[model samples]
Target chain A: MGKILGGDNMKIVMVEPINISMMKIEEYRQQLEAEGHQLIAYSSRAENDQEMIKRVKEADILIIANQPLSAKVINASKDLKMISVAFTGFDHIAMEACRENDILVSNSSGYANQAVAELAFGLVINLMRNIKDSDGAVRVGKTRKNLIGNELFGKNFGIIGFGSIGQKTAKIAAAFGCNILVDDHKQHKLGEELGVEYLPIDKLMQE
Target chain B: MGKILGGDNMKIVMVEPINISMMKIEEYRQQLEAEGHQLIAYSSRAENDQEMIKRVKEADILIIANQPLSAKVINASKDLKMISVAFTGFDHIAMEACRENDILVSNSSGYANQAVAELAFGLVINLMRNIKDSDGAVRVGKTRKNLIGNELFGKNFGIIGFGSIGQKTAKIAAAFGCNILVDDHKQHKLGEELGVEYLPIDKLMQE
Candidate 1:
């Protein structure tokens, strides 16, 4: 490994914008530079694989956010040692190339767990209350006649996945006095602690 | 009270249908009759003041559900002693008349507390996540460009009334990890137990 003035400074290149402001990226760059690291942040996405390759060729570490990293682009980065994905899912990355090259891959998981859980409740409430239809009716100065909506209380709320998002959703559903029914491949201790009943996927669907 | 074969039986008249079926009302009437009371139930709503006055004239106890019970109707009821309202609010009933006639007035409060609280959350979730707008957009085949929404988690949820509905609302909001700020005319011990911060109505409005 070659030594820089402060330490072994890595050339970290962010191939695509991660929805952060340029000023914020500059602040991050300054902080990293102070710690003996160099950061190259792009304000825009790479239009093509060639552009992606060009941006990541000399990077020791690459940062991306749901931008597809093909094997070709991954192979082009000869010095790439690690990839830091700014999204919960890393499927957009070339796992095969990273495995062959022994490049370490990390993702920003659990970041959107609360947000996703909240959205799940939002969608559930919308359907249960017929909010869209009610909103439309009120806008036209009409009253809800037979549009009396059902309540979530004492209802059986079934969740398919038992991940962070699912667990958070269950917590909220439980708060609303729902009997939670989970259908996950593996039994989670948290689900049990939450007083959730686990059933087969088919049974859960029926429930 | 008149002495019947069963016991001292008072005339119980249900002036209007309380959203219950005729069969259910008949069942109730049979049960009341079995207890030595004569129950006269009207399946339909009284359309006019005259109809309402006529319905209650011979009653000892009246049961109503949001149907207007004017002072004129109350005055016409010579044997009226008590009123059992099937709704949370009794403003539609003549309080002055009941006071003057020495009639006992009771209401079915807390019945719709959970339903109203759940609907409060439904409306909150809908607004926070833009569910209605998103639903509309999806139906029109348009993407949410700048329609990114705020999450209710870790947000301040201020409630105006600290009644049964408001307390239930605070419970659900707390479950969603919100900081509950309540503003009511009186401070409740339950609110304190729930770790809610009480504020003046004006102050809570600002929050």
Candidate 2:
């Protein structure tokens, strides 16, 4: 196992596909083989634990994306040294199995920071302006009588957490001329630079 | 008409209500009356041409929203010296009457610039991310199987008109990490400042 961990010809298996195309995966496989590592990339997720176990049996490092990796399969992967999660969340992965087998795990954090932040705006605008309702109304030749939407400009935008997603959301809100109020556990220099007002959770809720 | 224009106790009649509340209008009326100008703000729009003509019979200045101001109604306002449009668009008003009657016309332009620009984002995000469909899917216990949406983080945003609304829309787009392309009648220095590429209409459409 130690030899496999440090070996140049380690086997890497991707149990599930990421957002990339199969052609790209094949290109990656060839590139990794050229670097003395054997890459076995799966185009789809394993249907069952038995299949997952079989696929990861010879893998020194396994790549997965949102597919559930149970303790049974993880313990059965005798050569598994590390698990590379291609998603931001690793809750589906068997943490206890990794701990018991001393398997290292890495996740692609911050991969959806901007995407999620932008979605925050989308949801907010949908609520404020009644975008869904208005779109439906206009298609039916209805007037914007009761559907007069509210504006986000000159409004107080409250952010509960000051993580990467929160910071990106604050930037977009500021671009729309919103005053940002943050109630994170700790104050950040970046928040201060963005002129965000820091308040307690209670006070932020009132705002 | 010259006397009406230069009169100290000029009567201003608002034929239709703007977005402001009637209480605010009452406040404005009191303020205007204190300055030797009488402001008669109707809580609702004029029901007919007769009501409109009767309303503006004594008005030296007419303030209207989207209520149609026909040439007949405009011709009947003998004392009308100026038309103060409370809306951005004055197309509903009789522009020909204003010209024939030598009445100066003014509109509240640029009032909805930021509001319109923000709405542009709302609509774009709705279309790109399939927000409406995804929202419906989740409400019905469906997953994002075919509703995996696109992101606006790295996209080309085209602005055909580089007016106030277009400039504001460009600012928000730039904040979202989009490459902006413009095809206004003339190149704007602000577009260059924002690193927006000014292309021909056909070229911009390709982007």
Candidate 3:
């Protein structure tokens, strides 16, 4: 079996719960253990920064769900070489501290792209159609007032982020015959491929 | 050319304002008129049921956003044949009355499936990791306290309604390493193909 750092087995500790299904955890754990790594999982709240530091003091790799690791916690852990985050948003963790200590940080990306983009479209339709509000009125035995909603057939859709999620959103928007406008930090060639218009963030936001 | 029964072009009454960038109502109206149908668009609330009824009495097709059409309004329209709803949910309309009157009522169903399902997954992860709650805390300049979230790998995903929307949801859930359990009105072979276990509604709800 493969090993980390020429060791027979690597000891990895989860700093917090990774918001995923139990089966997924078991699967990942099995895969890791098969490769000669020991996985330690905890489902309790860290009592304090000190408690967290103490628990991870012996871990070779630390996997965090959403918990923030302070400079002190990183400094206290002498054996930590890698930090794998389950969530995409990494604004919580002190990256500078991890960098200073030479701890590798990895975050999950492109997993929730389809899910987040789909939800944004659903919310827009829900807001436009008042489906929930009408359902609430009917559920309470109130006289049903038909709330008029507009068709999404030909609307303008402005996407803020042109990441994987944004591209997926644009595809769905196109299927509904929407005119798409995308604003992103990086230059997007999708405008030519998907018939989307690229606009500056400030100008796009204004419209 | 196609012609209305009354010889004059048939009118299409729109109840609410719709964002029409890709497909303009005027374009549709002209196309319909070329085929010998008139289009009359409305964007005002009904002062009273009588006023609303009078406006819609001669309409061949009624286009609504979310305004509720009571049974009274349905009965008042002597020439109404079709009601095209812009949104997905049709709970606001009087389905029984429309059935009795032979007035066809159709709503957008598969349009926002991807969007809504995406949101559900996003919410699941966000709630599990306390991302939004943590972001709110950090925005106020509070010291970060990491919350533990469950890993999504190898979890049981119970899905209701195995239609296009539910199936789409199952596909995304599978990408996250979830074992899907589906509940639907009709037997679906797709569930078996996707390796999703089919269960009764009661059992699904209980789980």
Interface RMSD, one decimal, each candidate: 1.1, 0.8, 7.6
- Candidate 1, B36: how far from true, in Å? 9.8
lDDT of 1 by residue, B17-39 (tens): 88788888889888888888999
User: Candidate 3: misplaced stretches above 4 Å?
Assistant: A1-6, A20-37, A141-146, B1-207
Q: On residues B106-199, what C-alpha lDDT tens digit does candidate 2 reach at each position?
A: 8999988987998888888888889999988999999888887788998999998898889999988988999999988887778987899888
Which of the predicted structures, 1 or 3, would earn the higher lDDT when compared with the native? Answer: 1
- Residue B112 local lDDT, model 1: 87
DockQ of each: 0.66, 0.60, 0.06
TM-score of each: 0.79, 0.74, 0.50
Of 1 and 2, which scores higher on lDDT? Answer: 2
The complex in candidate 3 yields a DockQ of 0.06
For model 3, the local distance difference test gives 0.74
Q: Give the better candidate number (1 or 2) by DockQ.
A: 1
- Once fitted onto the true fold, the runs of candidate 2 whose alpha carbons sit more than 4 angstroms away are A1-59, A67-76, A91-102, A140-146, A160-163, A183-189, A198-206, B1-59, B67-76, B91-102, B160-163, B183-189, B199-203
Best of the candidates, DockQ: 1
Docking class of 2: medium
- Which wins on lDDT, candidate 2 or candidate 3? 2
Q: Give the TM-score comparing model 1 with the true structure, all chains together.
A: 0.79
TM-score of model 3 (CA atoms): 0.50
